[model samples]
Target: MNVTLTLALFIAAWALLDYLKPQFVANLEDNILSFLLAIITLVSFGQVVARYGFNTGWSAALEFNMLAFSWLILFGMSYGIRTRLHLGVDILLQKVGPQTAKMLGIFGGLLGAFYALIILDGAVLSIVGVDKEGGAITYFAKMYKVGIGVEEMKYPAFVQEMFGLKRPHVQRWVVLLILPISLGLLAYRCLQASWHIYTGQCGSLIAGHEAESLVEENRGALKD
Candidate 1:
C-alpha cells in the first residue's frame, strides 16, 4: 500500500541523510515549521481584522488555523528532538557521574525512539499494516480513493467550471497525511540523538543546560 511504501522510503532517506546529510534534508523540518507558523499567523491576523472591522471574514479561517496548528505541533516534536530542545528533569542524570550519565541519556534516547514507534502500532501495524482492514494507516488510502473532503473549504464555482465537476472541499487525507510521517520522523530523531550521545558527539538528550544558559544570557536585560 501507499502508506507502507512511504514509510519504507522514509527509512531509506534517513540512512542516506546520515551519510550525506545535505542541507535540505537537515533543514526540512525547520522549513516546514516556519511555513506553517507563517501561514497560521497571517490568516489569524487577517481573520480578526476582517471580522471586527468589516463584519465579515473567511468562514474557513478557523478550520484552516486548527489544521495548521496541529501540523505545527506534530512536526515540532521531531524538530525539538533533533535540536535537543526537549526538556527533561535531569535530576537523576546530575547525580550520576559523567560516564554513567552519558550511558543513561543514551538509554533514554533509545527508549524514546521505541515509544514513538510503538505508539504508531495502534494506528499502524509495523508501519506496514496487519492487512487492509486491520490498520488505521490504510484508512488514509481509503479516504483518498473515495475523494472525501473536509467539511469546510468547499471548492469555488470556478473550479467546477474548469474541471466540469465540483469537489466538495480540500481533502481530509491530504491534510492528515502528515500524521504517519511525523511519527516516523520522531523515531528517527530519537535514534539519531541516541547514537550521537553514545559517540560523544552530543551531551544530554534534555535541553535543561542549554535552557539555563539561554536564561542567564537574558537575565541582565530582564533585571533592567
Candidate 2:
C-alpha cells in the first residue's frame, strides 16, 4: 500500500482497537501511532526548513504549519460529517428501538453516500480542470515575455514575474490535491458506514446508540 493508505488503515485499526479491545495493547498501539505521527510531522517540518531556510524564523513556520494543520482538520471534519460522526440529537434516536435506529442510520448513510458522490464528481472535475491548466495560471501575454532570446525556450513567466513582484512561490499544488483525495476517502467511509448498517454492525462499528444510552443512564444515576 502507499503511505497514505497505510496510515489510513493504521488509523482504522486504532479506531477498531479503541472500540473492541480498549485495553493495554490497544492503548499501546494508540501511543505508537501517535509517536509515528509526531515523527512524520517533525520530518515534514525538517524538509520545510531545509527548503525554505530558517531565515523566516518561527512565526512564518508556525503560520505555514498552522495552514497545513487547518487543512487536515477541515478534511477530517468533512469526512466525519459524511459518516454522521458530527454531533446530533441522539435522544430521539435512542428512544426508538434498534430497528428504527438502524433504519435511520441506514437512511443517514444513504444520504451521506449521495452527498459524497456529488463531492467526488466535483473533485474529479476539479482534477480535470487542474490537468487542463497544466497546474499553472498563465495568461497568454504573461506566458510570452519570459524568454532571454533563446528560440523555443519559452516558459510561463510566473517564476520571473513572482521574482519581479518579490513574492514567494508557495507551491500550493501539493495542497491542491488534498480536497479530491479527502473527498474520495469520505466516499469510501460513507460506503463503509452503509455496509456496516446493512449488516447490523453499525451499532458496533461506531459508538452510536450504545454510547448515548450509557451516557444518559450515567447521568440519570448521578441525579438519583
The candidate scoring highest on lDDT is: 1
Give per-residue CA lDDT, model 2, range 119-172, as digits (tens): 434333353353222211122123333322322222246865856633243434
Each candidate's lDDT (Cα)?
Answer: 0.79, 0.52
lDDT (Cα, tens digit) per residue for candidate 1, span 110-203: 8888777665545433455544133335556677788888978766778767877557588788887777777778888889889999899888
**lDDT of the structure predicted as candidate 2:** 0.52
Position 49, candidate 1: lDDT: 95
User: Which residue pairs in candidate 1 have backbone atoms (N, alpha carbon, C) closer than 3 angstroms, thus clashing?
Assistant: none
Off by over 4 Å in 2: 1-59, 78-85, 122-168, 204-209, 212-224
lDDT of model 1, residue 70:
95
